[model samples]
Target chain A: MRLIHAATGEGFNPPSAKDFELPPFIEGVDWATKPILLAFLSVIFISVFFIAASRKAAVVPSKLQFAGEGVYNFVREGLGREIIGHDFLKFVPYLFTLFTFILVNNFFGIIPFLQFPTMSRVSFPYVLAAITFFIFHYVGIKKQGIVKYLREIMFMPGVPKPVYILLTPIEIATYFLVRPLTLSLRLFANMFAGHLLLLVFFLGGEHLLNGVLGLKLVSPFAFVIGIGLTFFEFMVQVLQAYIFTLLTALYIAGALADEH
Target chain B: MNKDENALWSIFGYLLSGLLVWGGIGYFVDRWLGYDRVFTLVGLLLGMGSALYLVWLRFGRHSG
Candidate 1:
């Protein structure tokens, strides 16, 4: 509130959702934006790092291999095996890819010069959630025949006959609509809000520099808070990535359950 | 711990979907009938009650 109070005539313009609309990298091509480029770059980085790490297999592991395995084992044991259980091996590859891909793209938020989280764009998260939606449904159908799966989702056992009319609709909506909708929205909101927070402090600090001497002295505090928030944003970025993958694994595990 | 977390999320999901779907239906029904907002409140209360019952069935029943 005091931010706008400091400037008398020309009030400080704080950052908003409009700031997220980044311009295209190529003027003529509409789709060629910074986030898209950064997404592709992340894919390449992950692919190369993993391939190089595994290329030279040795009993005594090197640094790259150790780092690669560390990430792999984390997903495999912590997420896949612990969450999915039993036939968790089959799902590890998907979980691993989801985890690393999200982690790298989210890290782009604080990575200098390329400070844009691709997932901050709603479309990216939507697509990722869609993939997860299809995969989990497919797994369920494959495991328990389509008829049984639908029956399980549509009708909960031990419920009174009349109650089905009320509970069934909620169950269907939760599974089909809310599940993926919440999944994607959670990631998109986190990245979008985190990016906006940093932009506010930094841009506000820059704007303050042009004001009177009293405001100018206060600018450094804004910059300092921005720096501190960047570190907090790092923790958020990592946690969001983990949660996204964890939820995906949980959904898959739920699908694979015989008695829903 | 993992199972507890899973249950919590499912409970949250069920509660949210319950309110949204039923309250949404009630809103449209009210609009169609040209009533004020009577059905919407009824639907919301019904949804919250049913969602709690569903949660008890899924999670609470197993505890005791």
Candidate 2:
């Protein structure tokens, strides 16, 4: 009976070996290698673009100047001045660099061959968050002494005494714990999820087109969804970059604000 | 305003407006993507982490 059971069809139906294969994109790279490579490439690309664009500057503005200035003003006037106030000129370069870098890298995610979103890597977002974090807080403390800064973040002047106790802990936790995490994760998750969805639809479409008989009928629907998602992904790519920069500015404001 | 006060206000205004703008973008992206809870959860974590890190560096670190 034992020998018969061992030889039975039920046990013979082993899982398909194909299930163990690595996806095409990730087949060669060592641990998180693709993201790192993409990030380095993005930096180089951005650096070269900026250096070339900024090589010549004119009062009347050349095509390069126009393009550069357009982005500069978009962030500086549209985002920076509107949020940080007119005195935001000091931080415009940093904001400009941040916005352009993220935008270009996010764009790189969708391009073939380099199909990874660099910001989807936790480390990249974390580094950006850390930089913004330091800038705002440092400016805050420098402007308002340590004691005042603490009071500004922790204590609201108008709240009742009992409420103050409750509010203080909540405020402290929200300000100190919650902010940076959300900032990094917001960019990370959007890019991560967006990339994943694109991958699923795209690969699903490809598989359907190439897979079993009669299953090919489903390929058109999958292909349509894939095409639609590509457009949607493009919008998200721009939106996420804008949000990352906007949030960085917001945190800076919160740190420097006298009240909540 | 004094130079310091001007600087502080400048940063504050930028940060506040920036947050609202980005926060709105995040909300819309989540809505459009249809992830609902997942998007909100991730956004919350990212936003909180960013805020906390900024605060720590500002107050915790001695060197500017």
Candidate 3:
């Protein structure tokens, strides 16, 4: 009697970084071409959509107006209010832009042809992180004056002299080194991992269905898992976008606050 | 030394905690997804690699 090989059958090649490649646009620009195009296209699309939506102001509001207002209010109230406090409204535009830009790019990752998440490329998220870093630091220095802000950041009120010697170096390292690193990595890693997982499940399912025999029964299971993972990826796409913006606000709040 | 420095330090603390919490979550998610120990191990390596690169940038490259 012949036994069915479940795990031994030809399985789908697990998705790797190489699987996600961008087509070349011209001669010298190969990898960078697609991302640049996507970024430019995203900016144009978002700008056009918002500008068109708000072009006409109505008392009752049209479908476009509703969309604009809903997105604006959601980012302003849900994320900004919760994280940035009273001054949240001031940064609404930046926050809205960040959210919409990231959300669109992330959704692009799952789209059939445009399968690259711009943020997954380190440079994209690094730029945002640098912007946040500069904004918060500038606000801290400008609001408190450079001297006062320095004092607030490095010297706490209650620590002992001996503790200061030990803690000061650690504190200094944390401020100058870790902040931007985490900021960039959080968004980058999330998009990278989420995309990788979706690739694995979908590609794995395809491979199992087509490449293997007798183990065809497992194809149904792989399909179910693939479907389930896609739904989860959708949730993650939104959540990561929210978390990225939320953390930016939180960092800004830290810069703006006086104590604690 | 000064209030601005203290604020910076405080913000850094907040950032560190945030990173630790989120990174820990990602690590656990990899474990839960049945990727075996390899996922967590890869994350650890990535974290260390990032940390080393950051140190090199901040201290090694910038000092000159």
Instruction: Name the best candidate (by lDDT).
Output: 1
Model 2: runs farther than 4 Å from truth? Answer: A1-32, B1-64
Q: Can you write out model 3's per-residue Cα lDDT over B7-38, one digit (the tens) per residue?
A: 44344454454345334555797878966556
C-alpha DockQ of every model: 0.88, 0.04, 0.07
lDDT of 2 at A229: 86
Of the native A-B interface contacts, what share survives in model 2?
A: 0.00
lDDT of 1 by residue, A1-260 (tens): 22345665578777777778989979899999888899999999999999999999799999999999999999999998898999999999999999999999999999999998989999999999999999999999999999999999988889889999889989999999999999999999999999999998999999899889999999999999999999999999999999999999999999999985
Candidate 1's DockQ: 0.88
The residue-by-residue lDDT of candidate 2 on A126-223, one tens digit each, is 99888888888898898788889988877655545774533355456555655676778889888877877777677767767776777789888887
Candidate 2 or 1, higher lDDT? 1
Encode model 3's per-residue lDDT on A186-251: one tens digit a residue: 889888888887777777677777754866768778879877877787788888888778767776
Worst 10 residues of 3 chain A by lDDT: A163-172
Model 2: per-residue lDDT, tens digit, B1-64? 2234433533443344334433555677788987665665565555545444444434345543
State the lDDT at A243 in candidate 3: 72
* Clash pairs for candidate 1: none
